[model samples]
Target: MRNGGCCPKLDPLPGEEESAVRTSHWRKELERRRDSVERETDGSNMKTATRKKDGEKEVRAMAPLAPQLCSRLAQKAMMRSSVTKSMASRDRVRFNVGGQLFETTSTTLANAGRDSMLGALLDDSWNPGQPEYFLDRNPACFSVLLDLLRTGALHIPANVPQKLLYREALYYGLLDHVRNAKWGPFDGNRLRLADSVPGRAPGDGTAIRAAPDGGCCVAHGSVVHVYNWMLEERRPISLDYQQVNDVGYIDADSIVITARERLGRAEGGMAVFSAATGELQHRFRVEHGQQPKSFTAGALSLAGPDDNRIFSSCKGRLNEYGIGMWDLNTGQQGDFFYELPGCSLGDADILQWLPSKNCLMVATLFPRTDNCFIGLLDFRAKTIPWSWSDAGIVVTLEDKRVLHAIAMEDGHSICVINQYEDLGFIDLRAGTGTNSAGTGVRWSSRSKLMNRKVPFEESCYPKLATHNGQLFSCMNDSISVFSGSEHVLTSTLSRSYGGSICDFSIGGDRLFALHNEDNVFDVWETSPSPII
Candidate 1:
């Protein structure tokens, strides 16, 4: 008898494809945007001649150009579908945001604190005109676009293979899109992120900076070793692999694995790997120490400007003191941004970073305090250079087994209000005090989407992973995957080859972990054993 086991992704029945088809709606808006830019630029050029008055200098607009041609060379922008007396009957583009409908030829969105890794997907296509143009796009996609527009380069997470993303960008000529804004897929009606992303070494390896998995620092006398519970079986087949002063966790196939120990340095520090198999990619340590005079550096941000990249306040006084920047492409330490005047050393954690405002939103609970303060740390100015403003409430992940990811503001903090846990969303944008929140995620539509709230603990084994559409989590030895009410689970190997299951971290659709008696790390797929 095949003993069944549960894992973290959805395995649709027999031959049924278990992946989520919930693609972000892109075509309709792309059509509207393309039409608008063309018309606006072309019309404006035409109007420039008409709008010019008697006294005004000849303010000639840019010369007109065709849509596809203009897109390739930037002669003009795509025309928007709009109207004048000649086109009064033309229908306008409609946008639905957070359930509100608006009649705007185009939409604009503010992506202050969205995930930058996701932003990287939008980076290839440049010169997209403006952020408002993609307003009707998915919030996550829009946020990334807004981030790139504001910061020039979008931040990629360390876990994603830079090569894979680069390949996707290169394939779609994302660079052209970024440069012209006119670059669309073959359809010519949608803003396309690449069609074929290179498969992950272990498939679907996204950034884990925000996974429920947190690093466990074990002190062997003076030296501190970083370890994570590999619930499944992973490489290096050890109870807990040592981080070796390596402040971040790269993807399963780390481009470079540096096992170096930098004493006290930030810029120009070198990292050395014993095995060179996949070793240290770059060099740069974060500044450490404390207030007053100055502080020496040590740690680095786990991910990047995005919340996934974070500061490892693991050193003395400065351990949790300042912020460190970890590059996703390369595991090198980029730069360090420390906190000032504020008491975030231990209590505060970066929930997310608002690239638009250059602000760091942290979730911290200070002493002499009953509530946790989700403060916004702005590093835009000089001098002490940091300001603190409170986000309505505090949130945290209570699971000891599962890894934790927290994003403060917009609506979520530690969780994305999905089928997994008591994760709730407070829509601050609605102006409703802190009380208004969304319950279980839109799991499926067959029923009410959400019926009753089970205790958060019961949601364990709650295989959690999100790709283009579905949100997944596991329960016990079973893996449950869901998208609205349309979801399923696959039970394969069940009977425990026992030992306290260390952990379960998912990337691409693969889960990595090490069990009790196994010295080898195991990789499990959402489906059976094949990569779809």
Candidate 2:
């Protein structure tokens, strides 16, 4: 064969030429297959690139809607979470108390105050999944207290004992609620007779002092009977027949008792005792000539709530007659106001500390002496700036003897009451430069309008007290309440059972009146306002 191309080609034998042609055909076939595969691959690659570019374009086109979708999903999640919390907060709670079931809301439990046991249930630890709470308590009392939490009113069933209810109330921290619902805040004009306790001995209650915790102590001869707010006697303070002169509360837990000096032993004086235990805490001693002298303490007076000084009238054998001040915290003597010539400090029946004027009012009322003497002693200056006495004043039919006196809250005047139910006022501003004997008292006959139908066998001296800008006076078997700026007689409180009222004390939003006949004492409390 001739080679027509520019390059020369070599000829082969017949069989070899056939074989070579088959080989050439096989190689061309393989090349053609490779080229076809490469074309298919290129087509596939181009299609894949186009699909990727389309996916990217689609992603770019949807970019603005992505944030809106995410925000909508977030809002939906927040709404679900808030709904869950709201449902949890509004979920009802059940309490299985003493096998009794109680159902209440979280808001109702919250009204019990966070410090209370029921209110504590609203805390986070209280699982909302919890179906019921169990409390092993008196169910009846629990029911009453739960009602109190619901309605802010306490109603005890007839079967439930008051003491048992009180115990439950204390356990639930609802005693204040119960007390408020029962007695309410003290209003002198809206007083009601709550209870009466008979004395240990008839006509033996010498003095009745009120406690800060709505308790009281009655001095019966040498023994002092202390009663709590529930009228339950705690302990009797006895002085071993030494005769208790006066008793006052240094605080809610402590009581200072003044007893007459023993005849020869010189042991009876002023001692502070525990109101609950009746144990002696400390003894107040008077020192004269640098030696502890045996003395007798009289009326007790506290400086003020912020002050720690206690003042007591002291009398001794030598010359220890004066007002002795002692540090109530340390029981050490602070200072002594020696008895002045015209002012009888030792025999003062009433000693009141005036914080506004920074002075002490010492009054030696009648029956203790032939005349009455009321003097304001400034301890800093050691001078009687103002005083009033009925010494030289002529006694007339219209002038009644001043039995009891109390300084007004304003510190401008002193209120005095007589046995004939006459109210008098002594102006402190008018008698600035005058002597105690020359200070005149203005008497008012407004209280005399309330007349008694019949006279009693025993005469009860009237007492005067100023509280919440109102005046309280107890005469005979009744107590008169005076109100307004002029102190007009507005209301009268009288009881039929107890005889003539001997003494009355106003404290802790309650009034305690001690009667003379049966040694009975009456409790008066103000009613709460109606809930709207």
**Tens digit of per-residue lDDT, candidate 2, span 350-396:** 99999888999988988888778888988888888888888766376
RMSD of each: 34.4, 16.5
> Cα lDDT of model 2 overall?
0.85
For all predicted structures, in order, the TM-scores are: 0.35, 0.81
Q: Which candidate is the best by lDDT?
A: 2
* Decoy 2 TM-score against native: 0.81
Residue 526 lDDT, candidate 2, scale 0-100: 90
Worst 10 residues of 1 by lDDT: 182-191
lDDT, candidate 2, at 115: 92
Clashes of each: 78, 0
- The residue-level lDDT of candidate 1 at 500 comes to 25
